[model samples]
Structures are given as C-alpha cells and as structure tokens.
Target chain A: MEAKNSAKERMVQSALELFHQRGIRGASVDEILKRSRAGKGQFSHYFKNKDGLVLAVVDYLEAIIRSGQVDSNYSFSSWDDFEGWFGRYIGFQKEVDCELSCPLGTIGNDLTNDQDHLRRAVKSFFDWSTAQLARFFAERKAAGELVESADPDALADLCMVVMEGGMLMSKITRSTALFERAADQVLSYIRSLR
Target chain B: MEAKNSAKERMVQSALELFHQRGIRGASVDEILKRSRAGKGQFSHYFKNKDGLVLAVVDYLEAIIRSGQVDSNYSFSSWDDFEGWFGRYIGFQKEVDCELSCPLGTIGNDLTNDQDHLRRAVKSFFDWSTAQLARFFAERKAAGELVESADPDALADLCMVVMEGGMLMSKITRSTALFERAADQVLSYIRSLR
Candidate 1:
C-alpha cells in the first residue's frame, strides 16, 4: 500500500511539473512516466490516461491551495493582511522570474471545450478557491472589519478575476507592471469598501 | 495569385477554428488540411509549419481586432460609450453561449513556455490591442471626455486585464455572472475617471 501511494504521488508530481512547463498536450504520458521513474503499468493503474492524470493534477493543486502552501502565514484579518498576501504573491512571481503561471489558470486555459471532465475539475478548483476567500471576507464583515455594503462573494470573484487576468498579462508581457496595476485597482476597491 | 490567396485564407480560417475548438496541440495538421480542403502541400507552401500557421492565426486575429469586426459601432467617446461597448460584448457572449473564449487569450495560454516565436506573436497581438485602446482613451482625454488624471495607457491595461480575466472566469464557470462583475467594476472605474 505504501509503495502504491508513493508511486501515485510521484506520477502526479511529475505530471504537474511537466504540464506547467510544456502545457497539457506538450507533456506526454511516456515522458511523465519516465520522469516519475514509475513503471508504465503504474501510470495506467493510477490514471486512466493523460486526461485522467490532468484531473489528478487539478486535485493535487487544489489540495496545495487548500493547505495554504501558496501563502501559509497570511490571514484575511485586516486590510494589512490582504496587502501582505498580495505583496508576497507578486514577490514570488519576481522570485521565479515571472515564468510561473498559475497552475490552475494554465491547466484551465489549455483544455479544449470538449474536455468537459477536465473543465469541470478546473471549475471546481476555481469555485472552491473563490468560495474560501468569500468565507474569509464574510467573517471579516461579520466582525466589522469590512464595510456593510461590501458583498463578500462579489468582491472575492473580482479579486480572482483580476488576479488571473493580471497573471496572464504578466506572463505575456514578461513584466509585473500589468499585475501591479491590477493589484492596485483591486486593493483600492477593497479599501473603498473599508 | 487569387487562387493561392484563397487557399492560404482557407487554411488560416480552418486553423483558427480548430485551434479554438480543440486547443493548439489538440488540433492536428492533417485535420487542418482536411478541414481546409487544401492539398497537404499547400500548408508547407503557405506556412513553414504548424508554428508558422499559428503565427498567421495570431495575425488574422489581430486583423479582426484592428478592423473592428468584433464590435465596430461603439466608439469609446464617453462613459456611456464604454458601457455600450461592454453591453454589446456581453450580449455577444450570451449570443455565443459564453463559449467564445478570446481567440488571442486561448491561443496564448495554450503555448508552451519555450515557444518563443508563438509567445512573441501572442504578445504582439496583446500589445497592439492594448495600444489601440490606449489611443482611444487618449482621444477621450484630449476631447475632455475623460479626466486629466486618467492615464490612457494604464486605463487601457486595466480594461484588458479585466476583460481577458473575465472571459476566463466566465468560460470556467459556464456562466456570465463573473463577467458581469468584472464589467461592472471596470465601468465604475472608467466612470470615476470622468
């Protein structure tokens, strides 16, 4: 059982890295298996195919987001908290030389319209992340940290849109200027609500 | 010459359609040839290869934007103009059932990180689009329709970010709600500038 789980983990990890670097179709099943050092049978045993592996990658990414691996220390307790979180995120983008695309965004964009299963997985991940942020804002509102007029759900959705958009533009431009503009605008909107 | 141009056009049209439907890597060269009804040799005759074909598609999309084929009537002359343009855009989204991802955005996202030629092509499309909008905003500011504090370039960047971001979210959720939120915020920001 232990060996099985580790092999599965290895495949998922390898798939995630290759997919990020080469995109979904660019990364092949054979390459993933070779990189993971897992036998060919292990891949078939763990995943139905490349598409199935992609779904697993989505779930893995969701787990990472949920576990706070992206930004473990930040809490949405105050305005400062939000700024700190965004600052770190932008800083991390710089740390990686702006080559890092959002794992979810990259996967989501690479999927074809016929890829209903993968699309749903990506959608669920975004919905889950958005809902988590919404809940945080709702809590802040309940505690009077946010203004009465601020709709937590709407705000959360806006933040996600801007962040994703910003990331896409940043990746294309190879500069963080677009993202900073987006972050500034979102921060101002949040501040206005306060 | 006419026959050659038409054949080239057919291939570009077919490639654009297939790439949008199946993604870049998902669309095969043989499929593009079959759909275009062009001789297999025509592809090499017109384009160096699939990557060259993708560059042509980028140029085609850029031409569409430049020609104002997407939304030609509404000029960004005032706040109401912005709203009208966005309204038509959202209406088009509904007309297409929200499956119409930004052609440039979709292709740009699917490219591998190492695809410098394709990446540069996508970046040029974005820069051209942003510059066109920036010129519009500059006109508005010159005509006193927008506030003096408004920077046309920055405003244009924000609009593009929100728009591409909104399209992505809308595509994922399979709902127009996220797009509406993004459009609303962007409109509000533009309005505030006036």
Candidate 2:
C-alpha cells in the first residue's frame, strides 16, 4: 500500500512538471508514466486514466498555493508585500525567458469544452488565489485603510485578470514589455484607491 | 487562376472555423480539407503545409479585427465607446457560454515555444489591438479629457490584459461571474481617470 501511494505521488509530480513545460495536451500519458518511472499497471491501479491524473495535479497545485509558497506569500497584508508579489511576476517572466505562462492558466487555456472537469479543476486554483487577495482587501477596508466603497471582490478579480493577461502577452511576445507596462499601471491604479 | 483562389479561400475559412471550434491541434488537416470540400491538390497548391495554413488563419483573424467587425467596433474614440466595447465582452462570454476564449489568445496559449512564428502572428493581433486603444487614450489626453499624468500605452495594455484575463476566467469557470466583476471594476477604474 505504501509503495502504491508513492507511485501515485510520483506520477502526479511528473505530470505537473510535464504539463507545465509541454502544455496539458502536449504531454501524452505514456510519457507521463515513463517520467514517473511507474508501469502501466501502476498507473491504471492509481489514476484510472489521464483525466483523473489531471484532477490530482490540479489539487497538488492548490496545496502549493495554500502553503503560501509563491504569490500567495504576500497575503496582501501590507502594501510592501503587494509590490513585492507583483514585482516577482516581472522577475518570473524574465527567469522563464517568457516561454511559460501561469501553470493554472496554461492548463485552462489548453483545455476544451469537452474537458469540463479539467477546466473546473483549473478554476479552483484561480478561485483560491483570488480569495487570498480578496481577504487582504476586505481586511484593509475593515481597518479603513481602503475606501468604504472599494469592492474587494472586484479588485481581487482585476488583479487576477491583469496578471493573467500580462502573462499571456509575455508568453506570446517572448518579452516582458507588455507585462512590465501592465504591472506599472495596475500597481499605480491600485495605489490610488488607498 | 480564379478557381484556384476560390479553393484557397475556402480552405482558409474552413481552417478558421475548425480551429475555433476544435482548437488548433484538435483540428486535423484532413478534417479541414473535408470540411472545405477541397481536394488534397488544392491544399498543397495554396498553403503547402499545416503551419502555412495556421499563419493564414492568424492573418484572417487579424483582418476580422481590422474590419472593425467585432470588438474593434468601438475604436475607443470616446469613453462611451470604451464602455460599450468592454460591455460587449461581457455579452460575448454569455453568448459563447464562456467556453471559448479570445480567438487570438486561444491560439497564442495553444502554441509551444518552438512555434514562435505562429506566436508572432498572434502577437501582431495583440499589437494592433493595443495600438487602437492607445490611440484612444492619446486622443483623450490631447483633448484634455484625461489627466496629463495618464500614460496612454500603459492604459491600453491594461485594457487588453483585463479583457484577455477575464475571458480566460470565464472559460475556466464556465460562467461570466469573474468577467462581469472584472469588467465592472476596470470600467470604474478608467472612469475615475477622466
């Protein structure tokens, strides 16, 4: 039983990496199994199929966010953290050479309507991410740091849109020009609300 | 010669429809040919290969935008046109049932790094879209309708990001909730600038 769980964990991790690098559809099931070092029997016994594995991959991603490891690190507790978080995106595009996009977004965009279950899995990550940002705004408003009329949900959603959209542009252009400009404007706009 | 041109147009139009409905990779060459009712001779006689067809499709999509047949309808000459343009996105997500994303972005996201040429074709559309919006913002600043502090390029890119980002979320959640909130917030933010 322990070995079985280990194989499943390995498969999920491998899928996550491959999906990020090659896109969700670009990675085949056999390649995933090979990378996991797991046999066909083990995969069938564990995931049942590729869709099941994709769902697990998404769940793992959510765990990463919940752990407050990356963007969620800011928690929007302070303006400094907000700037730090947004700045990281600029650094991130350069680090990745503007080749990759948001893991969640890349998956979401790769999926089709027939892949509804997979799309929903991606949405869960977006929802969780937005909630973290919204909590910060709500807290700020409660403390009068933000204006009374400031819409936390809308603000949070805007932040997500800006980041996702900017990331998409960066990936397409192979340059962070659009993302850099977008980040500057969005940061200033958000600052004005305070 | 005219007959050959007719066949070429049919192939491109069919490719556009198929790519939009089934995704870039999902639509095979044979399927596109079958849908076009054109023979294999016509395929090679025109595009030469699938990548060629993809480039043509990207150009076709750009033409659609330039014709102001869709979102470019607003041209963003005035604030009312800006609001109308953004509003159309909300309506669009509903019309497509949040299943399809920005045609330009969908192609960009689906492409891998090796497909840089295709990515650039998609980028041209983005560049054009940004220029149209930037022109609007620039006009506003010149007319003293907007603050002197406003950066026209940044504002235009922000608009692109919001729309692209909102379309992505709508596609993921299979609902327009995130998009509606984002559009409302972004619209209000821009309004405050004037």
Candidate 3:
C-alpha cells in the first residue's frame, strides 16, 4: 500500500513538473511515466489516465498554495503583511528568472473549454484566494482605512488579476519588469485609497 | 503567384485558429496542414517547419493587432479613448464566451523555454504596446493631468499586466468577473494618479 501510494505521488509530481515546463496537452502520458520511472501498470492502477493524473496534480497544487490547511494565510491584517505576501512573488520571479509561472496558473491557462472538471478545480483556487483578499479589504474598510465607496470584492479580484497577469507577462518576457511594476502600483494604489 | 501566396495565408489562418483552440504544440503541423487543405510540399515551400509557420502566424496576429500600420493607435489621447480601448476586450470576451485568449497571448503562453525566436516576437508586441501606453501617460503628465511622481512607464506596464492577467483569469474561470473587476480597478487606479 505504501509503495502504491508513493507511485501515485511520483506520477503526480512528474505530471505537475511536466505540465509546468510544457503544457498539459503538450506533455504526454508516456513522457510523465518515463520521467517518474513508474511502470505502465502502476500508472494505470494509480492514475488511470492523463486526466486523472492532472486532477491529482491540481489537488497537490492546491495543498501547497493553501499550505495544507483549510483556511490559510490568505487574509492580511496589516500593510506590511500585505507587502510581505505580495513581495514574495516578485522575489520568486527573480529567483526563477521568470522562467516559470505559478504551477497552478500554468495548468489553469493550459486548460481547454472542454475540460470542465479541471476548470472548476482551477477556478476554486482563484475564487478562494480572491475571497481571502476580500476579507482583508473588508477588515480595512471596517476599521475606516478604506473609503466608504470601495468595493472589497472588486479590489480583491483586481489584485488577483494584476498578480496573475504580471506573472504571465513576466514568464513570457523572461523579465520581471511587468510583474514588479504591477506589484508596486497595486500596493500603492490600495494604500492611496486608505 | 497569388495562388501560392493564398495557400500560405490559408495555412497561417488555420494555424492561428488551431493555436487559439488548442495550444502551439497542441496543434500539430499535420493538423494545420489538414485544416488549411494545403499540400505538404507547399507547406515546406512556404514555412520550413512548425517554428517557421508560428512566426508567420505571429506576423499575422501583429498585423491585426496593430492594424497593418507602422505606428498604430496604441496611444489613448483621452480617458474616453482609453475606456473605449479597454472596453473592447470585455466585449470580445463576451463575444467569444471566454473560450479563447488573444491568439498571440495563447501562443505566447504555450511556448517552451527553448523557443527564443517566438518569445522575442511575442515580447515585441507587448513592448510596443506598453511604450505607446507610456506615451499616453507622458502626454497626460505634460498636460498637467497626472501627478509629478507618476511613472508613465510603470503605470503603462501595469495596464498591460492587468489587461493580460484579467483576460487569463477570465478565460480560465469562464466568467468575466476577474477581468471586469481588474478592468474597473486599473482604470480607477490610473485615474487616481491623475
């Protein structure tokens, strides 16, 4: 049983890496199995197919992104906390030299219209993160930091937007200019509102 | 001569459509040829391989995006002009049901790390557009419409970031919520700088 679960985990890890390097459809089952060094029989028993493997990878990504907790540190109470949260990505982009986007984002963008289950899984992450951001904004509003007309939901959604968008552009440009600028502007823009 | 040029054009059009529908590697050369109904010989004569074909498609996308002109209307003289420019993307997402991203963006995201030529080509469009946006901000600053400390270059980069990011999130979620909110926030955020 231990060996079986390990085989499945290896497959998911390989799939996730491969999906990030290439795309979901761009990476084949054989390539993943080869990369994982897992037998064909094991793959069939563990994942059944590529779609099953992808679903497993999504779960894995969610776990890491949410830090393996139900309610993670998605909400920030202070400006410093928000900066810490936001700046981490800029640091990450520089670390990787903008070679890779967020694993979940790479998978999310690779999805086709027909991949209904995958879309829902991916959307769940964005929705959950955005909701957390909204909570942070709402806390500020309640404390009279934000103006009365500010919409927490929309502001949270915009943060997700620029962050995700900036990452994508950076990865494509192979430079952190877009992502860094977006981060700077968003932080100050929100602060200005306060 | 016209017949041969038309065949190549058809191939590019098919390639553009397929790349948008799937991804770069997801859409095979064979599939593009099949869709274009062109012979393999003609494909070889026009575009040596998938890379060559993708370059042609990039050129095609740029022509459309820049409207076949050298310096297109990438700059926005007025806020209404900016809104009109930004609003078109919202309408586009609705029209396409968020099934596809910008064809160039779709291609850009699908690229592997080794494809340098394609990456440069993709980067050029973004650079050009961002520069135009910076020009708009600079004009605003010159007119005393923007604050003295505002960085036109950074703000323009933010616009590109949000626009690209919003489209990506919108496409993934199959809802305009993220894009709409990002659009709203970016516009207002920039206006706050003025």
lDDT of 1 by residue, B18-124 (tens): 88765788799999989989887889898988899999998888787667776733245555666676566567678778775667777887776677788888888
What are the runs in model 1 whose C-alpha is more than 4 Å off?
Answer: A1-5, A72-75, A143-148, B1-5, B72-75, B142-149
Candidate order by decreasing lDDT: 3, 2, 1
DockQ comparison, 2 vs 3, better candidate: 3
How accurate is chain B of model 1, given as a TM-score from 0 to 1?
Answer: 0.88
What lDDT does model 2 reach?
0.82
Question: What's the CA error at residue A173 for candidate 1, in Å?
Answer: 1.5
- State which docking tier applies to candidate 1: medium
Q: Report the poorest 10 consecutive residues by lDDT, candidate 1 chain A.
A: A70-79
Evaluated at residue B122, the lDDT of candidate 2 is: 92
Name the 10 consecutive residues with the lowest summed lDDT in model 3 chain B: B68-77
Error of model 3, residue B38, in angstroms: 1.0
Q: Where is model 3 more than 4 Å wrong at Cα?
A: A1-5, A68-75, B1-5, B68-75
The per-prediction CA RMSD against the true structure, in angstroms, equals 2.5, 2.3, 2.5
True contact recovery of candidate 2: 0.67
CAPRI-style grade of the A/B interface in model 3: medium
Task: Mark the regions of model 2 whose C-alpha exceeds 4 Å error after superposition.
Answer: A1-5, A71-74, B1-5
TM-score for chain A, prediction 3: 0.91
